[model samples]
Target chain A: MSKQELTILGRAADDACCQGLASAPLDEQRAADLAKIFKALGDPVRLRLMSMIASREGGEVCVCELTPAFDLSQPTISHHLKLLRQAGLIDCERRGTWVYYWVLPGVLDRLAGFLAVPHSAKEPV
Target chain B: MSKQELTILGRAADDACCQGLASAPLDEQRAADLAKIFKALGDPVRLRLMSMIASREGGEVCVCELTPAFDLSQPTISHHLKLLRQAGLIDCERRGTWVYYWVLPGVLDRLAGFLAVPHSAKEPV
Candidate 1:
């Protein structure tokens, strides 16, 4: 389910790269789809998890390492990680006893591109 | 209250412009603050409203104009607008009977900048 969602999101990001938010109004289906991605990043815990995973030097982090950084229970942290994965922002794999996570390559930059205002739109009218 | 929140959010965005999400792990306070902004944009209605207002040729849109585009009541639209305003992504003013809204100058770009991954961070490890 998560991989399928990521493919859908990847397509949306590709479409967004061409027009961006300021270039034209978003259609309802696209808006609904994109909203899910933004909603996933809407929580403080989730955002921090994303930062932790995205900022890791070796491109991925083990679940054991991540759970120690927060005051929340390991279950709670796992739930947040699940949401990020569902949003197509990150993916995880089990290695021995631990699950390792990494931000999907270029997802952040694609989202940034979608939100960015084109230079032409920024000029005074 | 809204103005004060905007100021705080503005300060956060300014700090974010210097170091994006992927640059380092976010501190708790900053993550909480940014989460509010992203939460505001997480709604499909609000995202559509933002796109409409931001894409307007004249850089502003009246409340009357925004209402007709949605299947929702005027008050509902106003409420969504209020959330966006509180998030510091947009601002509004009353002119007689109508409220006009415009995306706060450079706010979208700043947010885009904050989410953007630094080129160096993308290098294969």
Candidate 2:
């Protein structure tokens, strides 16, 4: 995404103001932005990779540590990780021989908050 | 999905207890289930369609009303709606000649809540 696009997402997270999809539809740009993230998460392997990274100790994990946990090759795991990074769901930095990854704070929160039903809609119908 | 698969999704949502993908790697069954939902949300047209249905006035919108909002053909819109229904994110009822769509309720909530970061990981690093 461009800086401007990132800013829109930043604003949504900072304000915590995105309404539930049930309450109102997303604007075109927002829907497009969100769909990309959801698309990145659509794969079983990628989703598992994200979970491992997000829930890891200290909220981050190294590529080396993540590789052995799966039946897939290191390159395959790295490919999944690369997709997550491109979606802005996670970020990584090289630390000596291994690259460590962590969830980019608030992206998931924005999504979770976006889907949250308003108080009026929370009760059973 | 088969009744067995529906049972699994029902179990996950009813329990309100899917661990966030970032928390731990998703087991094969859970990953496959969630990936289908995420994949349904992956498309730009489908995402907008879902948001429109989810956030529509009176909690529903008819196929007639929805088609005009897009540049696509009615069949195209219907195809997207079908995908949403197949994903279990929304359902519809036919009243007269038109079919009205609405979010299924809790399905988005389950997906949203599933992405939520645990309290332990909430603080900024």
Candidate 3:
């Protein structure tokens, strides 16, 4: 599944979705996929979680480290992490007694590219 | 209301949010604001409408031109537009019989900037 998503992101980032909404009409399927990613980011907790994970040194962080930062229960934090993982914005691996999570850069790049202002559109005259 | 948003955006574009999630932890209020915008973008129908309006030749589009693009009723489209407007992603003006809507580039620029990959992290070398 991770490999498939990598392929999707590679394609999306390299070519399929490099334009902003102002550049062209977004197709239905792409809109659906993008919507899911945005919806996954539609919560404060998850958004903060994503930031913490993405900003961590070594580009990944342990679940044990992550849980302490939130006021919520560990299980609640796990649920938010699960939702983020399901959205393809994050991935995790079990390592000994703890699992580590990291942001999928390709996914973020695709989303950012989609919202990018074209060089022509950068300064509206 | 719009003048206020533009003031906020002008500041946001100039300084307040020039980094991606990986650069720092998003604050509570900013997180809430961004989440609202992302949630407004969570629906497929609304996403399409945003694309259509943003991609229009004049950077603005009429409701009459927008409604026929969807199978949904005018009221349904209007509801989605209302949500998008409330989120500050787009704004509309009533002119005689039709309302014209246009993308708020400052808002998009802010969102895109927030998701942008830091230059140093691009290659991950």
In TM-score terms, which candidate is top?
Answer: 1
TM-score of chain B alone in model 1:
0.91
Off by over 4 Å in 1: A1-4, A120-125, B1-4, B120-125
> How good is the docking of model 2, by CAPRI class?
medium
Position B122, candidate 2: lDDT:
61
Chain A only TM-scores, each candidate in turn: 0.90, 0.79, 0.81
Worst 10 residues of 3 chain A by lDDT: A1-10
Over A28-64, each residue of candidate 1 has an lDDT whose tens digit, in order, gives: 9888878888898889999999999888998899999
Clashes of 1: 0
Give the range of the ten consecutive residues with the poorest summed lDDT in model 1 chain B: B116-125
Model 1 residue A7 distance off true place after TM-score fit, in angstroms: 1.0
Clashing pairs in 1: none
DockQ category of candidate 1 = high
Task: Give the Cα error of residue A27 in candidate 3, in Å.
Answer: 1.8
Error of 2 at A34 (Å): 0.7
CAPRI category for model 3: medium
TM-score, chain A only, candidate 1, equals: 0.90
TM-score of 3: 0.85
Candidate order by DockQ, decreasing, is 1, 3, 2
In candidate 3, how many Å is residue B82 off? 0.9
